[model samples]
Target: MKVAIASDGGNVAQHFGKCQEYAVFDVVDGRSENFSYIPNPGHQPGFLPKYLKGLNVDCIIAGGMGQKALNLFAENNIQPIVGISGEVKQVMEDYINGKLTSGASLCTHPDGQHHDCDGHC
Candidate 1:
């Protein structure tokens, strides 16, 4: 399976749409195989979901994502795991080891302003 973690530098970005890049990791037999970073294509409505789907992304891991993007990902048959933070490598490892859990973080807007994001993830 392939997992995409919305990231900035190496950490999971606070908000999915405003994230700088994506760390795409491939896993097989429940073990991670490899990873690559991809720049954010753009944050226009449903564009990202489609773009990621084209890359055959199976799941998305992020700190937060609004309702629209989550719905689009669902529509595209891509599972989304939100409320994740910390560096991408650790997050991925935790997930692979079945230690990561989704928190209650949800971004209502792309700007990441005027929203309560602190510790929400």
Candidate 2:
């Protein structure tokens, strides 16, 4: 299976849409195959889902994602694993080791600011 992880430098981005790049990792039989980094195409409504789907990503791992983004991913048959934060390599390794477990989102859009966070306060 192929996994796309939302990343910024060495850590998981706080927001999926604002991530600088995506580290695409391919896993076969519980072993990681190869990995590559792709620049974020764009952060438009429903755009990310299409972009990731085009890459044949089976799942998306990220620090946080809003409900709309989650819905879009579901619509495209892409599973999202949110509330994760750490180095891209570690995340991938955890996945390969069957230690990564997905839970609820860890972020909340305070003050109704749904958009334009852009990785900064």
lDDT of each: 0.83, 0.84
User: Clashes per prediction?
Assistant: 0, 0
lDDT of 2: 0.84
User: In model 2, which regions exceed 4 Å deviation?
Assistant: 117-121
What tens-digit string does per-residue lDDT give for candidate 2 at 35-115? 889999877777889899999999999888878788889999999999898999999999889888877665457665554
Can you give the lDDT of residue 92 in candidate 1? Answer: 94
**Per-residue alpha-carbon lDDT of model 1 for 5-65, expressed as tens digits?**
9999999987787789999989888888878999998776678889999999999999887
Clashing pairs in 2: none
Per TM-score, the best of the predicted structures is 2
For candidate 1, the per-residue lDDT at 106 reads 55
Q: Clashing residue pairs in candidate 1, if any?
A: none
Candidate number achieving the greatest lDDT relative to the actual structure: 2
Q: In model 2, state the lDDT of residue 59.
A: 95
